[model samples]
Target: MKKEQQEKSFTMSGEKRSKVYEEEAAYLRNRRSVAGTHTTDRSGIAFSGGGIRSACFSLGILNWLERSGMWKEFDYVSSVSGGGYAVASVLEREFDGEGSGKTRAEMVVDKLRHDDGYLRSKSATLFLLVISASISGLLTFSPIMLLCGQSASLMINIYPRTVDNWASGIFCAASAVISLSTWRMPGMVGKLTLFIAVFFGSIQVAWVTGYLPPNLRVGMGILLILSWLIVLGLLGLGLSHPLIKRIQRASFLGLMANIVLTFAIVLHLVIDGTGKTHTNDVLACLYIVSLGLIFLALLASPNRLNPFLVTYYKSLQTAFGNGRDDAIWRNRAQQGDPIHLINCFVQSPRTREEPVRSRGGENFCISRFFCGSQSLDYFRTATWSSGREKKPVWRHQTIWRLITTSGAAVDVHPTRQSPIVNGLPTMFNIGLCSWVINPSFKRKHRKGGPVFVLNFAAAVGGNSIKQKWIRLSDGGHFENLGLYELVARQCMDIIVVDAGCDPEYRFSDLALAMEKCRDDFGAEIDIPGLFPQRSPGRCHQSKFEGYIRYRGVDKPAKLTYLKLVVTEHHSMRMRLQSSIDPKFPHEPTRNQFSTKAFVDAYYQLGCETAALAFPVTGTVKRAA
Candidate 1:
């Protein structure tokens, strides 16, 4: 009995040892994965925005991927705007296999097909509303202005020249409005609406200022000035609040742009119509000089930098002044305001005679004053030096205290944050249109958003311009959509399912997406061949369909773009499939897939695209 017990105890000990060894192996593997010591074998797929078609296509592709055993391999799936619907549907749906007897992808497609289901989605309806509202808002005053200006046309005894006068007035008004409004609206759709409203409003203002007598012009101008003052006062009210600084900046930029343009138009009408410049060459010269003086005065006037540029410049200053450089220089830069440092950088070379060279690969310029051998080394590159031995901490020069600027308010530098520092002539520097590395390695949403300069091309407003701070829209407006976000997250292999509803079948959107990767993020993706502008006519055309690999080296990730093609049969099927009456929910009828049948067809088409792109051979470069 004792021998049998001893054997059992020995077997149990061996089992315990085996379990400990397995746990240790798992721990090591997990550590390697977390540390990224081993090459990552993870895949991420992203869906682009394309109304209903994108929803159908993404769902279908996901369904096909699941069947081919590739769906489970994806570590992440992301989307923007319209594509969000499909992603949200999949995430929200119950895929328990027992309920509804439908797969998650199938259920999502069905929901899109349902009249009430698809129409109920706020995103689906938002596009049309924005378009319609924009159009209506712009033309709100056009008809009334037209009728008032052409009242003589209804009079039987009126001269035929009345028609000409009305037409000319209408044209002039539209031109003036367009000129005034164009600079104010930054968004594509917003610009369109501004054009329309300005067209009508310009007509009335032109008639009042151009044709009206001198007495009437005075009264009208006075009224306009009063109205403008009231509006400005209202806008300025409570702008000092920090929470609404963004909103205030955006609104103020638009209003200021409009005000300047309006003033210019009115001045032109007054000067030209009243013969202010018709006297002689002397009058013309005086007029030109007066205009120049006005422009210079406007430039000198205190105004906010366009909010977008302000944000970018703030980021740039923070990047340079933060303690990211060598110990001595970093400490010195940190003591000074970022804007001041930028000013100094621009004026560093001072005259053309001063030589400029990198102390290394680092972004440093030779100083004007000699520090001898102390500033020659890479550790302490020659930089702009103050006369004082000890650097003073500088504060941002605030022109308008009514609104909070982009960066956080730091402690005032007693040495440099005085009138002497603030009174220096400021220059608008566009040469340093580059990004600076952000020190804080946290999510953008946390800690008051990420701190980095944006592309100069994206600025809507800036100093020396009327626009103080223009509003920007989603990344989708720029065509790259959500792909940049995925790239920023450092995905290994990015599968971009191109689902944008391009009626012309152009690849401009794809081009823009690639540019952001290459230029903005320094991705090495290259297109082997250019895509044609128009489709080959047939919905089933093979010219631009299927998957094309975008090879990436180093930081920029590899991408596989799956372009989808819709056929006549598929389009018809998507239109016929329905779950509710046409009037019941006012179902979406504008898109390619309006009904249940069309939705199902696109869903099936998506599955086919996925199958063709991702075969089961395991030969394709799987993300993992």
Candidate 2:
């Protein structure tokens, strides 16, 4: 018994041993990684915002996923606790030998001497990091989106655009160079320094020796990266580690190329002071600049680095089973369905320098895709108008409908009147519009073809300009033939396009229309509120004229409608622009269109003047 006990103790000690003592003197490898850099008090306020943002993002997404019924399969919430703890343990300063960073380093070292194996492993890790970053970036707007089945149109609409893709290429290239140069790779100091110096020094030498010029740097850089990629592939093949070999085969070179161009064009306008240039060029530059950085950041994230990206390369990874329907029937899943809506992504012709608008459209697109897709599965119904027609090219059946700004909901004219309308802008008085029809509702809602999903190309997020646009009503309604039977509508049969006075479509109007539609349509069950509530928390009221005054600072225009009326119970903060990024171009001066003050000038005067005749109810929640 004593001998056995000694043996067991020896084995246990071996199991617990990590490389903690190998090079404990080094601060980076010896100390710890900074993962939860936001939660610590030593962290900056910017970190605080990011931490709060991430938490809100996590909570919001999880809640939506559960509500959408996808939470059952994903198990993201429960798994998050374990995953978070594991990550914390590995990232903390005190944790010994469990870090993947260290393990990956050791693994690399094992094959370093074998050129072919080393090359392949390196390439594999790089490629994996690329895919992970792209996918992660894509998921930011649509976390619950499914990538396969009848709902693939959702993927199409959500995919990044040409310019954005180009930008990603630029961003990835820069990040790769930066990371490679700065990598605190686990190795002898002399060896590490030599590696970085050799690789980086080669580029510098190429430039100084006139082998590469500023104009041709991009081309030269590509060649440099390609050389690395080839070396990795050969190295990986020699080692026969399928994962690294897969990365070599997948080709990060091409993907990064696309992203690099995206970066060049996007940066042309952002920091180039080219807003006065052609719109196409300006737009192109803006996209590449923003998207490039984003992609680069993704490649740099450690969790996504090395050997994990082998998963997405399989285009045929049968994600979920489709019902026994023919391909023809299967593909037309999104046509004119209550749960499916066509969204557009607009961009100029490769180059432009223009002011980009991020707020209005992208918000509408994501909300519709995420919220609309979710409602169909748990709260609404989706029908394939194309399924009935039997063709991919016909009607509202396909997943993505690319309409232009001309298709924008605001232009359609209103033919009727709301008698109560007096001084209100004619835009809001309009009543019904198309796009709200529920044709599939009358028919037994057969489990709608695999959940039609929504995609938010980073374009649509609040970052800058959005190439992806999800069509929604602007100060209008689409109550056609009651909410039940969609009146046997045809794909292009013109669903009686009617408009009223409202020029802008706000949440307040949608909620009202939904409520009235309950009885007007005579449905068996009426959802109490598909829209959010309207109060200080849920609703915001602003006029175009009032907003114009918030922009100027010098002769800061006193907005006719923007004077605040603050009080005790309620403290309102209003500005021409969003309060989050309150500063405007003419902060100290006045552009007559720039923001000057951030005030609520109590609603007393505005409200008293306009009796609460058109009060809407709902909570105004910001998009996560």
Residues 362-462, candidate 2, lDDT per residue (tens digit)? Answer: 11111121212111111111232322233322222211111111122322221121111200111121111112212223223221221101112212111
Residue 236 C-alpha lDDT in model 2: 31
Across residues 63-178, which tens digit of lDDT does each residue of candidate 1 receive?
Answer: 77655655554545555434544554454444545644455666655545554224232453445444433332223222222333232122111133366556656665666666
Which stretches of model 1 miss by more than 4 angstroms? 1-39, 97-101, 120-473, 533-558, 566-593, 617-624
Output the number of the lDDT-best candidate. Answer: 1
Q: Candidate 1: lDDT of 514?
A: 66
Candidate 1, residue 83: the lDDT equals: 52
Task: Using TM-score, give the best candidate's number.
Answer: 1
Q: Please give the lDDT score for candidate 1.
A: 0.38
